[model samples]
Target: MDPRIDFLYLSEPDMIAAGVLDAKRCVEVCEETFALLGKGDYLMGGANHNNHGMNIVFPKETKFPNMPVAGPDRRFAAMPGYLGGRFDVCGNKWYGSNHANIEKGLPRSILTMMLNDKETGAPLALMSANLLSAARTGGVPGAAARHLVNKGAKVVSVVGCGPINKACFTAIMTQLEGVEKVVCFDLFLDKANEFARWVQGEYGVGAVGVDDTEAGFRDADVITVAASRLRPLYFEDEWIKQGATILVSGPFNTDESFLTSARIVYDHTALQEAYVEDAIASGNKEAYYSGVIGGPFFRLIDAGKLPALKDSTSLGDVVNGAKPGRADLKERVIFIACGMAVFDISWGFELLQNARARGIGQSLNLWERPHQG
Candidate 1:
């Protein structure tokens, strides 16, 4: 065995230097990962091997005197998974989040990932995962954009112009051409305007802030919703034009007609089943899935409109050539991007491998010998 072992430390800047924000590459890596997922070469937590993992929730009222008070989006979670094919590795992303961080001018979530040795359960890299998480989160839909949307999708309406959506918008722009107009909508108009300027400056596309969400959706050939709203989705189906593709990266709401007619797709059916499992386990299906874009589909199944949950197709199948992405250009498709940890690991693994080859990131060595007898 080698006498010494060192893992690279990737700060945010190091991640940038290592091409962590390159959505184009992240999308490609995710494409491969999805292909593998379609082939059943992956394992996530839970009885179905597809669970999204258990999220730690906080109480509004704390019993412990010294415990921190609960706030919105304030919780901790551990997402663990393993990929099988060529990139046979296992790991987890652990993080604590607080929506109140914005009051302190900080991001809502602070995340980190540990790449592990498959056999020994040792960490290969303790790396910053903000960009890693953001890119993979955005890149999945960007890959969907490649397959689902029409060839000449000129207009893209961004429902949420936050950091994650920024990554999503940029990545879709890379694959799409003649995307001259970008319409943005956010509860905070200033953030939307700021996003507009950034998009215009970065991609040379025309960015405009629209007061009406429906107006933003009308002319858009592609729509991406990445807001942080927790309530039921209120976006009306009347707002979405025919022949448009909707990529939901955040929680959303839709009508019964749209839910029944539109082809409901998922990044992975198991991930959503994981949500159902969680709902059944916690007896809170209505609370968690009710307002979500996918929530309406579950409602339809309950209402006997759509088929069972198992009937939906996985995006990986579309990517792997087993199923078609857009059956016809006029078909309206709704893809709920329930993010998976394997995606982060898959792209993170590729980036780490690339960084090692290109000599990117800083390296630190652990102790030379074992501390315990």
Candidate 2:
């Protein structure tokens, strides 16, 4: 057997060429990944095997100047996981994020993904992952929309108006047909208008920008939240239409009137439970819960107001046919996912195969052969 190891290196353009921007395909792969996750065929970071990742968070006050102090959205995270089924591999999504990156003409978070061999530790591919991450992040909700959305959904309300939501819109539009309009809302009207115009240009949908958050939700069939964490986006019970699906990927706030009636679906229940366990053990459960999109529901679970974590429905279970997506029409539903590494690994594995098949990326040799040999 050849001892030499060479790994594929895919840059941003290569990733796009390799089909990383295919939201429909991303959703399909994410659905398969979710099924694997539901069948207990994956392992994430930490002992729980459901941990999101290990984050290097600098403190607010550090005595040494070289040791950087914490600022807005500054940290490094290593998310590692192994996925099973057709694509069985291990991988990690490593990223550095800082709110100040805009000053340097960089993205808030720059990411890369490394896929590895199951038996050997050598990498299969190392690729730029900004588009990969966005596609998967959007794909989860897109998958949820596939199984859970109300039939003939006509209008979609997009809150946040960021690039992530652009991908979400693409995936959802790919799955759900007859989408006639898109309402875009953001902290800045210019951003919202820009998103609306893009939607109109791409999909020929009657897209419009809205200044009022509530106005964005009115008469909408789907509401996607991927907004700022600094302030949780809140909605009134009256503003939301019946049978509307809310896909939350960021901070959110709404009254109990909606929660008591809405069926809350998780991306993966085990990960959220692991997060809850970690929070309780951290001795700051409230603050911990506050940091996540699912915090409100998880806190309610902790208080016994909501059902137990096991009792909750996950998108994975729905995909696996282990659980129903929706019980009845006119029952408002919310799907919340905090993101996971298995998604990156699965998609990365797929892109690697695609790129290899098409010979779309650079290949670098690790060694001619083992030095000892």
lDDT of each: 0.82, 0.90
After best superposition, candidate 2 residue 164: deviation in angstroms? 1.0
Clash count of each predicted structure: 1, 0
lDDT of 2 at 152: 82
- Per-model TM-score on C-alpha atoms: 0.95, 0.98
The numbered model that scores best in lDDT is: 2
- RMSD, every candidate, angstroms: 1.7, 1.2
Q: Write the per-residue lDDT of candidate 1 for residues 1-373, one digit (tens) a residue.
A: 7546677777777677778888899899888889988899999988888887667887778889987777777889899999988789998988889998889998899999888889977668878899899999889998888888888788899988788888887777767987879899887788889988888888887998865667667767899988766543367778777778889898877678887888777898878777777777767778766534467777677678988777778899899888788888788888889789999898888878878888888888875665773
**Deviation in angstroms for 192 in model 1?**
1.7
TM-score of model 2 (CA atoms)? 0.98
**Which segments of model 1 are wrong by more than 4 Å?**
2-4, 230-233, 291-293
After superposing all C-alphas onto the true structure, candidate 2 shows an RMSD in angstroms of 1.2
Q: Write candidate 2's Cα lDDT for 79-112 as tens digits.
A: 9999999988999999999999989999999999
Where is model 1 poorest over a 10-residue stretch in terms of lDDT? 227-236
Give lDDT: candidate 1, residue 265: 70
Q: How many angstroms is residue 144 displaced in model 1 relative to the true structure, after the best TM-score fit?
A: 0.4
